[model samples]
Target: MAACAPDPEPRERGSRSPSASGRTARPGEGLLAQWDADLLEAAGAGDAASVTALLDRGARIEARNEDGRGPLMLAALADRVEAATVLVERGADPDATDDLGDTPWVTCGVTGSVAMMRVIWEAGPDLTVPNRRGGSPLHPASERGHADYVREVLATTGIESVIDRVNYNGWTALLEAVALGDGGEPHQEITAMLLDVGADASLRDRNGRTALDHARARGYGVIEDLLA
Candidate 1:
């Protein structure tokens, strides 16, 4: 499963605090401020050329906006795969978490950007790192039923241990999948896949609710049968 966090849209360039052009500027208001502003603009627009230009001019590759989103995260959220790639190549922190504790990979998964997800995942993020709620990327993937992403993570990375990891609520991937109610065939299949992959079906959450109990209470007979 793809565990991603909710990504908010970035602010437009023009809306940013501007610096006065040419001299006449105060210590805090000079070329540096404008450069910072431009870096954010390049990130928001996914203009790789512009970003490269700024970076060549000594722009910090890891510049954060007022909202605390790094260039890489902004690019990923915009589905700008190329720009994201460029940023990553330029030393952008793939594991940089926003104020909300979401990394670029998590944002990609939550936004259902399969292509972006692939890019970030390939860049080598520690997928086991939990979000603010203590659920890893696998938790969101299973919850949202992103089967392909889920399968890719499992196949391409060492995600088996992550699958059975419990969250703040002590819910594992299987438990979240069961509680997510039938997101469709993908969800059902993912739930089944988790079990088949040796997810601990007998494990219970903080409330003492096991995946088996969740499936049974929700009338998910297929999942219940799988657990049994």
Candidate 2:
């Protein structure tokens, strides 16, 4: 299994650097750091009571740990729908991105969590938020064959129109789907849906081959015919 990458930056919301402690150490400094630690743990564990208690005690709701992961991000990663919902309702920014520029919506899309994604979307995440690679959450879902999640995102009136959106490599969601799909009935179905919805089947990637060319190279006869 691939190791889970750590968050690049850990924001110390209430922790004082050791340098500052040399001149004068405050009695409550230790207590404050401990409280922050508790808040992070509670958010990860999905303990609603603990979350509320910590926040009420002045914990930074958006505090990021060493990985730049906020409490809401942790909850979403854990698939705690209720906890995620609660955090968003408590004013967590749904559009908060990690150091890698992956937002809550992008995480949900990558994890294939339709329910969690809906929660984030309803909380007002911009579906068009692109990552460092210029790919939005929709690209991952469509590429990974998360059909239900893809449908959910695509059904959003304006979002569906991005089916032909190309990334830095000039590969659209349709290109990704064709490249990664198994070429079965489902793959052909998705490909057809993409094309019918205005995906530019003829659009080539950096390699100068259209999505159908890739399908043909991979022996996806049905998908190739459908695109053709």
Per-candidate clashes come to 6, 2
Model 1: which ten-residue window has the lowest total lDDT?
A: 22-31
Model 1 over residues 1-228: C-alpha lDDT tens digits?
A: 998987977744433234466443222335556676788788778898988887876667777888788888888878888788788778787789888888887776566667777777767887667765788777877888888877776666677877777878778878888887584678788887787678888888888988888888888887777778
Off by over 4 Å in 2: 1-32
Candidate 2 lDDT tens digits, 68-165: 88888888888878778778888888778788777776787677788888777777877677755687776776677777777766676357656677
Instruction: Provide the lDDT at 23 for model 1.
Output: 40
Write down the TM-score for model 2.
Answer: 0.79
Instruction: Estimate TM-scores for all models.
Output: 0.80, 0.79
Candidate 2: count of backbone clashes, pairs at least 3 residues apart or interchain: 2
